[model samples]
Target: MTTTLRDAHGEALSTTDRSALAAYDHALDLFNGFRMDPVAVLAPVLERDPGFVSGQLLMAGMLLGSFDGQLFGMAKACVDAAAASLQKANERERSLLAAFGAWSNGDALRANQLLGRHLIDHPRDLLALQLAHLGDLFLGHSFMLRDRVARSLARWNADDKGYGYVLGMHAFGLEECNEYARAESVGRRACELQPHDSWAVHAVAHVCEMQGRVDDGIRWLKSTQRHWATDCGMAVHNHWHLALMQMASGDMDAALKLYDEAVAPAPEAIALNLNDASALLWRFQLRGVDVSGRWKALAARWRLQAAWGCSAFNDVHAVMALAAAGDEDASRAGMAAIAEAARLHGAHAWAVALPAGHGLQAFLAGQYARCAELLLPLLAASSPLGGSHAQRDLLHLTAIEAASRAGDRALVRAMGDERAARRLVGARPARTEDHVAA
Candidate 1:
């Protein structure tokens, strides 16, 4: 029932095999799931034809919906390819695409670096304006995200329905900084604007997770997974978050299974990072799992800080890896390296906190004394670490666990009692044991 192009005679030139069908299906699944790796997933088809508008839009949606660390190089490559194709995408489409690309690969500084000069020529150019706002948001500069969106909305509010996209994107950033009130308010607006909007829905999940509504967040994800199982981006990311939330809630069995089913099959970095990958090292430490040679592949991946590396947010795991390999010297040296990188880059977009890294190193080194001393200050400062309250909370909790190990009374109280207590929304008990769950 399959057909193939042939030469002048009628010989078969190529085959429409099952693999091709599966690849196309996979592409569609990626898109529907909200995984956001358009450049990576769609690269094959894209390389075959540059002016693939559908591919561009799919890629754009992935980029726009991005809530994790920036996929800078992949985005840049896609944008450059699309531009080279000269397909002349519409202004709104082009602007948002370029904005995500710059934000991802180029960084806020790079985006600002270009926007400053571009604004002089096209001051009110909506694309440039939107991107300027995005740069401001990430760089923690003075640019107003809502104000810019308001302007854009005023122009297209009536006819355009995608404004939810803008609001949802901003909501994710706000949630990252633990600005729950503002994030929730913005998220409500986004949801009202587009209830079915994947990004808007995802932003709300960030808020829920920050508020320690892990069950609610995971429930939402399960519902979303069912809704977007055919959707690639959403499926992978939703599974990633759900797995982490489960782990945090002490459902290790569920977490591990999800990791294998959802994360192992996917390439997102955060999935591995948040899911207690230290278990891999710990298993090796106990001589239970033969994870010795696993280091070469994983370390190589982490060293580049590429896709898998983004989730390498847990510096402790890195330390554990070095220590597990019988190289305490290597572990110390690696910490110094990451410490410098954190200072230089300042994990504003996707990293946890600098002190969290130090705290992780202490725990990895078994220097409970120093770990408590360093991380107590860190737990106090987690609110300002950026990204979202839940992430900061996780950082604090992780530190507190280390501090508790360090026998630091203050650190334990700060992370365990005070921190958890503050996360209470109602008359609920503060001691949820999320932090102390062995």
Candidate 2:
């Protein structure tokens, strides 16, 4: 008689070693909490149980999800290794491996479709649910972000191991879809259930930011600092959110302090971290702040990632860093990379991001009218370029600033009025605070 192996969620495991499955479960918990690198946690386990298909898939999925083209080789290796063990994999495991392979090969659409189908069949698969939710997020499929988690909610309950993380994912989706009130409620509940869920903390921060609740956003992030600020992979980003709130409240000094201390304290090769750094610095530039030294340092880090044009979002930020640093040649090279990426990945979001990149360049060059012209048409279509609404607001902000600099007050006012209307809808009054202890 053979004993079946099951995970914490009662999902069957391919590996017979209960200890390996426990390690895998621990990795998933770390990932769900956004506390540490799950790949690091799974490395030794996979070495011991080379046939652990789910572990291999999780590693591959995380590497591909990093959006670092340099990691594609490593992700491909994981895919190849998983394929070798496919004979031992269960149905859900096979589907997950296939999805990871698709993502590694740059077929995100196919990958997402496979993950979605896998989730439908195995709704209890938290790993699949997370990968699919992140896919929706990277593709800017806001509806799917909300609905994907919603679809699996029936299969989950309070007693489920990763229920709070699911709610965190849903909260971000709702916030992306402009359901601010519900997003905040769900996000808050998620945090209550799992205090250390940084993604949930970040989701509520998004709600406050989008609704212009700067004070509330500051308070929310500051109050939750203990949960997310230490050992959480998303610390920089949550701090980025706090810095944005500080900027909105006319506290540029405080924002810069956060930038120097928390947001981009050092150069990192990670595209996501670099994106937050570049975006925050660019916001400072838009306000006529002197960030030249900072830009020079940031541009150096971005130079390390210049060859990886797999992500349009990352490419745009690279352009910002190079251009702001007065590296004209490197800036031009970054633009060429964007063009090349757009030409090759026409079906992807790169094409949508090309104009935005050019518009940002124009804004930097003092070609205000041209900047507005290039960016205004892209405001509505920018979602496919992959980022949250708050992140994409950089484009809108540049356009409005350009119109103002071009002496087009009417255009600026119209754009500002439109933005104000959207932000003010269903917005509650922000409670006053003496100071943000960020």
Candidate 3:
């Protein structure tokens, strides 16, 4: 007799192969819980049952998550496998394959649209929902991120297996949309339901970070750090959060120390790790902390990926590292790569890149007025650039510094006052550095 396994929604998987079912279930659990090593778990399943369409779909999505150009070959293979096995899949599985096909072709928006319609018919499809979340993330559709989870919540209850994960995702979306209080509450509730849910932990961390609750952020991260420290995929990012809090408290030494211990020498040369490193070091540079020699190391790592053109956000960071290191050739090449990607991809690729590339180059050249002019307009549309609000805040910080350097005292003061009001700065940090001078 053949055995079947149910997905998070209790719907039976189309596959009856026992090993495939086991691997798929294990992969789902690890993925929904944000545990590490999901791909390793799924790989054997694909090997065992080449006809497993869902396995092919998932493995392809996982490869894309790396955002590494080298992995494109494997991702394409997975997509092709799914396409070849289409006849073996159910209607929903086939629909998912179609979406993955678009995703494999670098058309993320189309894949997301397909997933969106898939959800309208099968709101309980957790796999579809997960992919949709990625789509929202890549598009910088913050409102969509929050609303998509909200739309699916009616079909889930606390008793459901992955309900806590769903709530955690919703909490993150809310935080991205600036709904701090509700985000905190929902995220905390998710953590209560599933202590090991790293996404929930991350969501609450974002709330504290945005609210400028430095003490709260530190305390919460410290208390919950162990749950995600070992097995969670977002561990380094969580540490990055802690470092940000330390920086906000004017503990530059602590921030740098954290960077060395938890961040730099990334486990992988992937864009995600590289972005955090650049963001932190750039913060140091903005504060005139003399991050000498550091940019060279970062730029060296980025040189390997400078030509990947995977994302405009990543390309901009690469430019930052190269420009700081005085590698004019690499920086210019990075810009060229971004322009080509924008041209080949669409407006989504260049909309932010063109301005961001020029702005970064202008800032490096000490043309502060030009930098500010190029960056200010894109601040409101930063979401389309594809990163968390915290990550995209790099643009705001750079703009503020440019405005300060341009002798636009009124603009600088106005921006500072607005940040202060929103951040609820009762007592400012002691250091009055160049980053805050204006």
Where does model 1 exceed 4 Å of error?
Answer: 1-37, 40-107, 112-159, 173-196, 247-250, 265-333, 339-355, 380-386, 424-438
CA lDDT, candidate 1, residue 178? 60
Model 1: how far is 400 from its true place, Å?
A: 1.4
List TM-scores for all candidates, in order. Answer: 0.61, 0.94, 0.93
Error of 2 at 176 (Å): 1.0
Q: Show model 3 residue runs off by greater than 4 Å.
A: 1-5, 421-438
- Looking at model 3, the pairs that clash are none
Which 10 consecutive positions of candidate 1 have the poorest summed lDDT? 6-15
Q: Score residue 433 of candidate 2 by CA lDDT.
A: 14
Ranking by TM-score: 2, 3, 1
Error of 2 at 243 (Å): 0.2
Candidates, ranked, lDDT: 2, 3, 1
> Considering TM-score, which of the candidate structures 1 and 3 is the better prediction for this target?
3
Error of 2 at 271 (Å): 0.7
Error of 1 at 40 (Å): 7.9
lDDT-wise, the better of 2 and 3 is: 2
lDDT score of residue 390 within candidate 3: 79
